[model samples]
Target: MGGRLGGVGTGLALGGGLSYLAPQYGMACDSFKELEVVLPNGTITTASATSNPDLFFGLRGGGGNAFGIVTRYTVQSHPIGKFYAGTLVYVLDHSQAVLDAARDFIAYNTNPKASIMATYEVLTTPDVLLNLDKFIVVFLVYDGTEPGTAFRNFTQIPHLLDTSKPNKTYTEVAEMPIPYTAELSRADNVFRIGAHRIEGAAGLQRPRELYDRYAAWAAANKGLYVYVALNLYPVARSMTDASRARGGNAMQMPDGPWLWVRYILSTPPGLLPGVYDKVQASFRAMVEATPSAPGLPLFLNEAAADQRPLSTFPTYSRLQQIKRKYDPDGFFVNRTGGWTFD
Candidate 1:
C-alpha cells in the first residue's frame, strides 16, 4: 500500500517495520537525508535536516498523502551483508505454548540484532473451517548466523516446519515467501482489516482474548468468507529511542514492548449482498474488545479505515501545524486518503 521494497517509504514516514534493527541503526526515516516533493501547485522542493527543515521534520514519520508527492527520497545507505533469516511453522495445537513464548520473548529479550514476526492464522475454504490448517508462522532474522539467546524461546517451540536460511542476501530475504502482497483487486471481494494495540503484563491475556474472539467471530461467519487471519507484530520501544535520536518523527510510541494486532477477513464479491456493514461491525467489536496500553499508536500502513492513526500520534498538534504550513488551502487534505489533523 505504501510502495514496495514493501512500504519502505511509508515505513520511514510512519515509524513502522525495521523494529528489530531500529535500536541499532535507527528507523528508516532516521537515515532520510533528502526528499524531492511536488506540492499541490506543482512547486518542486528539496527537504532535509539542513534545508527546508520544517518539511523535513514533517515528512519523517508523518503519514503520506497529507503532505505532497515525493518525487524522490535521498536516504542514507548502509552496507549490504549476509544475515540469518528463516521461517518456522507450527500447528494450532501449539498455540498456547507459542503465544506464551512470544510474550516472554518480547518481555525479556534485549538483543538489538534479533527480530521476529509471529502470525497466528486459520486458513479457510468454502466448506471447511481450516482449524486443522491453522498455523503460527514465525519469521526469524538476525544480523548473524545465530539469532542468539534473544530468540531461544521461539527456536525451542515445537513446530511442524522450520526452513532457516543462513548468510542470505537482503534481496533474497526480501524475495522470500512472505504473505504480504501488492494486490488491490478484490477478485475475492472486500477484505476488512483491523488494528489494535496490546502491551504490558496483560500482554499474554489480551492477545489470547483477541485471538479467541477473532476465532469465534470467523467461525460464526465462516461460510461467508474465504479466510480470516490475525497477525501479531512486535513494537519494541527501543525503536522509539532510535527515532528520537534522529530528531524524532510523528509516530510517538508508548513505553515498552507492544504488539500491532491486525485482523484480515476475505469474502467473495457479492456472494453475501449487504453483508459488509455486518462484517465491519464485527471487526469493530473485535477491536473494542481488545485491551490497549495507554497512548499506544497505530501503524498507519496496516490500520483499518475507521481507526484513527493520526489522532493516535502524541504530536498531533505539531503535525497539524506542519500540515497548515505546507498546505494552508487544504488542497492535499481534500484530495488525499489519509486521516488528517483537521
Candidate 2:
C-alpha cells in the first residue's frame, strides 16, 4: 500500500488502484458510482450504470489516457475506523523464510479482513542472493483490531523492525513501510508488472523464483541501477466476487487467488542516451524471465508505459468500441499517454 495511498487521485483510482482493504471490498474502480467526463472532441457527459454505460465500462479499469478525462467522480465510501496494521522489516538473512511465509499466506489466507503486501528491496548492487545488500519490507493490515492467527507467520520471524500497532487510523496504515516524499518522487523509477495464477503449490514457487531472477539481474547490472524492488500483491477470491458484484470492470479480471508483482527499477539519474537504452534492454530481458501467466491483465497503476496493458483485458474488443465512439477523431489517442487501442 506504500505507493497506493498518501493520496489516491482520479487516475490511480480509475486505473485499478488497490489497497489493504481490497481483499474485503475490491479494487478502487469498483467503488465508482458516477463520473463526469470531458470527451476528446469537447463534449461533457456523465458515466455510470444508468448513464453512458459503455463509457463507464471502459473508464473503470481501462484507465490509460486513451479514454476521456474524468472531471468529477461520485464513488462509494467505506468506514475507515481503526484497524490492526503496520510495517515489518527483515534482513536479507531471513529472506527465504520471510518469502516462504508470504507465499503460504497468499495460498492459505482466507480471512477477508486480512490483507498484506510484501516487497523485497534491493538497495545496492553486487547482491548475491543471501547477502546484506537486500532486505524485505512487508505491510500487514487486518480490518479489526484483533488479527488472531492472521499475522503469526510474520510475527514468528525474527525481524529487524516492526511498526505494527493494534489500533491504526486509515491514514496511518496508508503511510506504513515508507512515506511518499519529494526525494522518492524525483527518483528515476520504472515499474514493470507481472501477473501469475495461484495454481496449487506453483504459487509458492513462482514468487520466490521471480524474486531470485530479479536479484540476479540487479547483480549482473551492478552500476546501471541504484535500487530495485519486487512487490507482491495478492488478489483474493472475495475480492473478485466483490468486483463482479459491482458489475465488473474493463480489466475483466478472472476469478482471483492470482498474483500481481510490481517490478521497480531505479536507474542512475543521468545516464548517456545510449547507455540508458542498454539499461532498459537489460531490464526488459529480466522481466521476460517470468512473463504474466497468459490471461491476467497487467495493472496500469504501476506498470511501465510500454507494457500495453489494455490488450490483455478480456473485454479488449468492447473497450475498442467504446474508444471509437468517444473519440472518433482519435484526439485522446493522439495527444495523451494511454494504452494503445489497436
Candidate 3:
C-alpha cells in the first residue's frame, strides 16, 4: 500500500486526499502534480501540468477546499530512504539565547544534507517549565543512512540537554510529539484556533525589540499562558527549486532567507477569551512594530485569519484567471471566506 512519488505527484494525490477526506493525512501542497475534480452539475474533469495545465497549477497550492472536489490524483514518485533526525530540548530561561543561536545557525546553514526545525514554548505550571520549559530544536539530515554526519555537527552546540539517535523514518520524524498537543486541543473547540502562526504579514523576521517584548510578555504571563513553539525548517533548495522548474509554483515565496516561527498561546478554557485577546493584541502589536517587506509568503493552511490577501496568492490576478477558467460557477469557496474568482 506504500509507494514513493516525486514531489509533484506526491503533492497532487496527498493534497487532494487530505482536503477531501482525511486531514490527518496532512497536506500535500508540496507534492502536487495532477488532479481529477468533480465540477458542478456532476461533471467530472481531469487536469495535469501537461493538459489543462492552468487547472493543474491552480490546484497545486491554490488551496483544496476552494478548488472543487478532487476525487483522484496522478502524482510523480521518487526513491526515498532512511534519514537522520532528532529533537534537542533546552530550559525556558535560555529562550532568548537559544532562539538567537537557532536563528544564526539557520541563517548561515549551508549543509545541503541537513534540515532543522527550532521551536519555543511558554508553560503554565513551573513544573512543566521545569520538565519541558526549554526550546526544542529538531534536526533532520537526509542522507539515506543512519548516524549521519549532520548529527556530529549539531552536537557541537554546547547548550543542548539531550539528543536522539539518528536513523529514523520520515514519518517517524514528522509525527514526533510537538509541545503541548493535548493542552492545545483541549483549550479550544477548533484546532484552527490552536494552530501555529508561521505565515503572512507576521513573518518570523521580527525586530530585536519585538522579540524582546514577546519574551518579556511570556515571562510576565508565565502561569496563565503556556507554550509558544516556533518552527524553522531547512528543506533542501533543490527540493523546492525543482518544483518550480517543472511548472509547479508554491515554493516561489519571498526572496530573503527566512525561518518559520510559530507562537502557540494557550490558557485554561475559562480564562481563554481574555488570554486569547491579550495574545492577539501582542501579536498584532509585534507585526505593526516591524517594517513591511515581501519576505515570506504565508502557508495558507497554517495562516492566521486576518493576514494580507496577497500573501497567500502572490500572483493574485493570475490565480484569479485560472480560478475563473476552471471554476466558472465559483462553486469552490474557502471556509474562512474572502477568496473570489471574479
Highest TM-score: which candidate? 2
What's the TM-score of each model vs. the native? 0.87, 0.94, 0.74
Q: lDDT tens string, model 2, 1-342? A: 223467655678778879788887788888889999988878889999999999998888788467787899898988777899888889877878888888788778899999988988776546555566777888888998999999899989999888888888887877664522214747577889989876867666887788789878877777777777888898888888888998988887888888899888887777898998998988988898788998899987878878888888889899999888888888876687657686
- Give the range where candidate 2 is weakest over 10 consecutive residues by summed lDDT: 176-185
lDDT of 1 by residue, 211-250 (tens): 7887777667765655667777665667666667767766
lDDT for each candidate structure? 0.66, 0.82, 0.49
lDDT of 3 at 93: 56
Residue-pair clashes per prediction, in order, are 1, 0, 13
Query: lDDT tens string, model 3, 1-342?
Result: 011211223333322221210111222443556679875546788877676777666676666545566788665544446766556666555555655565554455445455555655555555543555545554433445554454454465555555465566666655555566535457641111111122344433342344565566666666555455444443233434444545545325442344433445555556667677876677555544543334344544444556543344566668777766666766655332643443
Q: Candidates 1 and 3: which is better by lDDT?
A: 1
lDDT of 3: 0.49
How far does residue 148 in candidate 1 sit from its true spot (Å)? 2.6
Candidate achieving the largest lDDT:
2
